[model samples]
Target: MTSQYKSPRPLLGAALYASILDSLKAWLKSDGLAWLFAFKAALAAILAVGISMRLELPQPKTAMVTVFIVMRPQTGLVLARGFYRLCGTMVGVTVAMTLIAQFGQYSDVFIALTAIWIAICTAGAARNRNSRSYGFVLAGYTAALVGVPALQDPNAAFMIASTRVAELTLGIVCAGVVSALVFPLHASDEIETTLRAQSSSFFSYIAKTLPSRKAVEDVVAMHEHLITSLVNFESLRVVAVLETHGMRSRSQRMKRLTSELMAASTRFHILLHFRNQLRLSGDHQTLDTVNRCVGAIGRLLARSPDVLDTYASATGTAQRLDRLRLRVQRHLAYVAKQDGFTPVSSLNLATASDLINRFGTELSAYVHTYASLQDERHSRENWLEALTPKTDPFVALAAGARAAAATLTLGFFWIATAWPSGSTALAQGAAICALASTATNPFRLAIQIAGGTLIGGVVGTILVFGVYPHLDGFPLLALAIAVATMPGAFIMTRPKVAGFGIGYCVFMPALAGPDNPQSYLPEAFMNDAVALVIAMVVAAAAQALVMPATSLWFRHRITARLKAEIATAYGAPLRGLRAEFENGVRDLMAQQLMLPRHEGLPIRIPMAWLNSVLEIGTAIIDFREAAADITSRAGLSHLGPAQAAIRAVLPLFKKNTGELRSVAIDALRDSMLAARLAADDATLLPSERSRYRDLLTALNRIKHALRDPQNALGQTGQPSVAAPSSR
Candidate 1:
């Protein structure tokens, strides 16, 4: 039967299809989120009721809504956010209490201090464009969460604290429950898949670099894509902890495993800039041989990142890998090198090829490690995350920052103005806490805060008058809890923000809403609106000042990925020994495609540069590989003994394709190594004279442009924008 199988095309198609299915699964899980709100509401109600019953009072808690905000989307992030919240809360409360105590009740000084704290937190939140900054904001707000209500009744501090604690614990539990019961997304799978893909494409590009002489622009784009792919893992870390039971342990393990993968990817980009050092400027065959051998290693690393253990004892591994990295670096360094016209790019190409071959051999063991551990390493994180921390610092901070800042600022603002309503500031802080958590855009957050607060206030008024009057105990409470979800329903998808708004409207009124609507509705609306403005203004101001992040910072994340892919390609030969090489290629392709793909400077400038580099490199590689597949046999046909020896090892490329490709390419590598020694002498043997002359002539004709492939973290230094758009 005539075979229908093409080289790598069909296999590549299958992997692409597999990735599409995985993305679809993620999208499905992201939607259908009612359970999250249900869980939050039930917990909030339970805490409210428990505290109220224990204290034996008109209301057990005004803090239930605040508790729900304590947990965050991811565990580690929650841990961090929780830590910041704890610290910031402690600070804010101490300051509020101290001011209030020193200046007495209704002191205008307290309002000023609150405003300051709000601004500070807003500034801190602006520093990082992520949940981490939210912690700072929450810290500013935590003060009000505890201190504001105390203003209403100083003696009830213990009751307030207890109620808050209960509500917070309940809310955390709810987050876990909701996430667990729902489709339950585990980000680890996505992380691993992307990592693998980036690795492969990188190595594929690197291997073909020698023959195709692809430009730096070609591979630069891959680097941008690579950074995005890896960073997405960080994002997923936030979500992974929402699992139950065994999932927590698995998540921990995955984190460790993934961290190593990240480091390796970074190193691969380093290799791209160094690979050129191995070949003589004019030795084309030597360079091709060098690339093939080293590229095999690069491919292996990509395909078998999870299986490095097998290579623990590999021979000449580091030396060979470093040789390629150094050579590539030499080539790339020339562009930046001030010395101009020096040809140090070919300094050590031959030695590096030999090292790559040794590393390739060691990969056998690494594959063994992966095969043994792949199942356990891959599936357990999802299961382990079942019992991880429910909330992260990001959410807590967002809640705390908005809450504390608004409460204090508004509280003081009202007092200074001799405002008729004392709770107006408190009300605004509460609403801000809820709305900010869910907003993706700051302006939108402000708008939502206003809209949500107004609606929430109306909901509160209706309940306070219509429902509370008609029903007394459980029914009234249940209705109120259900109503807490009026805005909460919008939060089903953006729960943090939605919950933020819902909390204020539902909790404030439930805690202190008037029993009748005739004369009370107007006052409630006014207070809510004032509070909304205070929180929004404070946040916006702070965001504008201290360590503010522009969109450029967000864009740079993609540049970081491109660099990572470059280095990862260089390291592949030391990793996977089988079809793992192919897997690495697909992994990069998927991740490159996965970036949110928006417009901007830090992201686009580097992205355009990195993407073009990686793409061109990838295309050049594909063509050469195809050419090698068709013409390699013919090239050796003239060398009878060598040709017969190579033919006997037919299908070598297919068989030892990944890291093992170095092993098969070793035949060519051995010849190049010999040629290098001959070049060094400046007086070649008869055979060397012919081969070296031809090789050097060929290499010169092939392009020598190379640079460090963009890395995952992009560059260490955050360059300041020269103009308005650059930063």
Candidate 2:
């Protein structure tokens, strides 16, 4: 010991080494991923350029630019994007060639037709979601690039289109190959990690919030997070399926899992809503009983034997939930037989039991589906329906019109001015307009891209004029290009500055025009740079002034769509209806969250509308299911009043007049009375009575939700507690 203590330097050195190792590990998990992405992008760009140069392609820079555009952190994303980019390019080139052959003699006709094509593509892009949308964007911009340059020389149109397609193909292949082979990050792995994390976090959130009196703010935040995670998971699943055959085979199962998750979350929200209503009504007895049942559920989730971070763990959790489901059923049955329970409390208990049971069923299904992913022998033949996304046709049309207007205006200006780089400017403007069509804040994105293009132009000017002149050979050129493009590639990994990075990385290469024999013309470089900047500004102006998404009318349209979900719930077919309704409403909610607040719109309006939609839509689904059960067994004659009540409320959503509200309220009251009478009938079977009671609970929930002053359909805009009262 004395000899070891003789020198503390060794100990200090060991401690320092351990600290450095920890720091390195932390960095590798966070910023290191970004650094790795940047490195891969740079390598792909260099490879694209080197091959293009060797093959003597017309424009090596096109291939290089394509590399930056398609490069992503995950192999699946890169491959998916490359595939879509290829498709878009082929379609675009074909259209460009046809347009040139037909309208080349008339510049005005060609420009107008090209603008129309861009408009259609832009609309398609805006209407679609995720990677498919990128295909539409490329289709629009590719046509512009191919046709705009060939307007002056009709004979060269075929040559230009073919060469452009070839360069793009080369870039796509190179990017895909490099991304898949070198330090590859698989989307499957990402999906697994995300599923584990989201499942665990969501379980914890439900456990903590279910039995407690969490604030409204906390619930709202959780709602937002859940919606975001739902959207991201779907996007990741799309790309992951494209990456590997195994993932492709499991696509239906994955969709089923997500759908189950959505259903389970909706059940949780409904249960929470009922709980809050009871609490606000000062029905402590009912509230306590509901809380006790919910608390039991919370305990089961909190003490789950598995962490739900792996397939094995999820399997274990599914088994646990199944057992809990049975135990809860028995417990609820025992509670139902107990004395001293009021009618309202009995109804509340029955409703809570149904919701908790449904939640357990969905959660178990979700876990089983997730666990099945590990079992290749599991049956994959059954195709499960996925969430259907809804897009507003009017919004899409407005976006397309804006893009078309911008293209036509820029094209006419270019022809009138006859500037040397006017074609380049027109192409850039069309590309920007198409690309920004789907953006939440197109004007802001355009401005950011414009700023980045300005910076890219300066960097390109310096590199071409100052650095490239002194360089020789492909290796030196590659090195210089890598050095110049790495920062932008790194920036693209960040969400806040991704648009800027995209602008810089793409425009830099276009501005430099690094061909087989480098064009070092300073005037041309300056003109292209100025033209791109002006194009971006024009795109921004169009986005800001032409049917801006942030306008009051646009927000109202979104609000109207949300309100219509109740009608959808009433009319849509019951098969796979819940998933579709939930997905559509949540999608609209996501869109509403993205729009900036207007002077005429309060910040709470969207959330209020969202709560109403979830509450009323879900209740309608439950009521319909119960009605179907009753009709199939006995008859709908017993529940005629309830059906009438639902129909009455449907019209109130369109026009919230006082008269309509009063009629809806009266109908709901009569329906509840009829259900209560049916439940009390001695002639009814036990199972039949339970069904009628469940129907009554659903109607009561809808009534309370409507009367709650926090929602859009409430009688007053003021916030107040909703006291329980018998009409």
Candidate 3:
């Protein structure tokens, strides 16, 4: 009998194994902690800057920007968040200047506009679309920057504005400098992964395609899926800027490779459509040419440009096809089934051999035509468009106005209270607004800005009074300030965006009054506290009325999304499936948070219908795959009259494709009708023979799964009625 416990191994061997294992665990823990602290510290630093701006530094009116240059550390998301913060701040500054200047003397008017700004930001977040976010952020911060400052003595406003602009420029530069010095991110490996995944998807789809009638539809659907997943490459492109600091020479080939990959995707889509449209007597020559093109693209992905020359030349139509066929056959013979990829020969080899022998003469012309087509549309659907961006619960959780209000309030408090000599309420507002501009949550962002401003003010005072006078002159003091700035800058390179706070606090105080002997912390604290209270109050008021953004907005947008999904699901199954695949890509890019995990987080945005609709779309993909599988096995197109059946199939497949899509809608509609009838005994038909048999059955099954899909789908691995598979 086998014992449950084993005797101890040799002491040395056991010790070595345990030590290595322990070290790995320790390293992982250490790395994870570093990442976590770095993120929090960055955020904390940004908040500290807001505090500095509110303190009684000499020129406390300078606009301060804290940059957090995050390289996703994951190559795919390696974009610097620099632009987002920069744009948000600039827009806020402009809005603050305009609104304050226009409504300076009219007290209530400024409050009214502040409310409007909150409403606009909230509404901007209503949809899960990426493009819309840019607008929301722009508007939210603009209000904060402009509204809070106008509360100060009107004459001091312009000077505050000038100082604010100067501070902002300084903040932005500081952030960049810090980012460059810290751990920089890049996009090299991410682009490669995207291409590899697409290649991998093709082979996986092919495995699901064989012995299937809707083969072309499967191809089209899979093509769209990969395209969507890959487009997020746009985010990576931003990392290209990191090259200016000089070290991306190795990836110089990336630009061309990416372009080629995009071109190939478009070409593959065309070939798939052609295969679906071909007749029973479709020329084998075209098939061969298409095969060659697919192989060419795969080769490009699998090997570096340098490695490809080792392969034998592929000149002429038939020769090219042979090279492609040879490569594919090798894959089919060698690749493990779990690998989920192989060349196309195993898919249509019978059609291939016969076509080569019978239509050898036509091969060159078809190849020529295919090449021309590829050339014509190669650049249209690029990796950038495939994955550029979208919206989600992340946006819903965003609080734009709260942040703007916080910053503005802090600035306003300092000006109204008269702590910092040269600073106006408007300048403070501008600083707060700019800092809060990039925050997803207005409240949290406001806090961060307030905290940062305080920290910066403390540092500035310490340097200006505690250190400045002792220094020989302005130049020496400036030198001292610059030395203090390096560490702050280094910290800013990480994402928390807080390092800007340290720099602001250290330098802005010196800018305000050169080497002043007096310390200003006590008065600065009073002004900061007052400003915090006012900003919070203003933000709350704005959120409550005059175009409030509520979950109601989320419901409206999600409802519309649900209807669109339903409509797409009801189109011709094949083509409708294509559209659905496109929507999947949008979801993948915009809402980085994966679904089915929604319940893990507290419900932030109130779009319950969207969650429901997304489930429905997921169901439709499964249904389409299941239906196609059954239809293919039945050989619906080639029943008894084989040739005639094949001829008849084109129209039916082409025509019924449209009608079949209505099947989903009909099932939904008929189920409602059946439910009504079932309630009345007089209208009930024999349970098994009811006119609504199919529709009712489909509806009941959907109902069962909807009520408890985890159990039905068997995620827990107990007994279950499986939801239809997406093949």
Best TM-score goes to which candidate? 2
Query: Which is the better candidate, 2 or 3, if ranked by TM-score?
Result: 2
TM-score, cand. 2 vs. native: 0.94
Clash counts for the predictions, in order? 112, 0, 42
Off by more than 4 A, model 3:
1-94, 118-151, 155-163, 166-233, 238-388, 392-461, 482-526, 529-566, 569-727
| Residue range 1-727, candidate 2, lDDT tens digits | 8975688788899999999999999999889999899989989989988888888898999998899889999899898889888889888988988998888998898999999999999888888877877788889899999999899788888888888998999989999999999999888878888887777777888888875754333556677788878778988998898888888878888887777787888777777877777777677776776677778778878887355867888788788878878987898889888998887787777777777788788878887888888875577427567665645777788889889988998899888999878898899898888768878777777887787788899898899899988987878987898889989999989888788888898888888848877887878888888899888888888888888777877777777787777777898899988888888888888777777678786646666777788889998998888877774334455777657888888776677666888888899989998888888877777777778888887898888777766556775542322211210
Lowest summed lDDT window (length 10), candidate 2: 718-727
The candidate 1 region of ten consecutive residues with least summed lDDT is: 383-392
- List per-candidate RMSD values in Å: 15.9, 3.8, 15.4
Query: Per-residue lDDT of 285-401 in model 1, one digit per residue for the tens?
Result: 445545654555555445544322322312233444555555654543443344433243333342333233333333332233223333445432332212111122332344334
TM-score, per-candidate, Cα-based? 0.54, 0.94, 0.47
lDDT of 3 at 74: 30
lDDT of each: 0.43, 0.81, 0.39
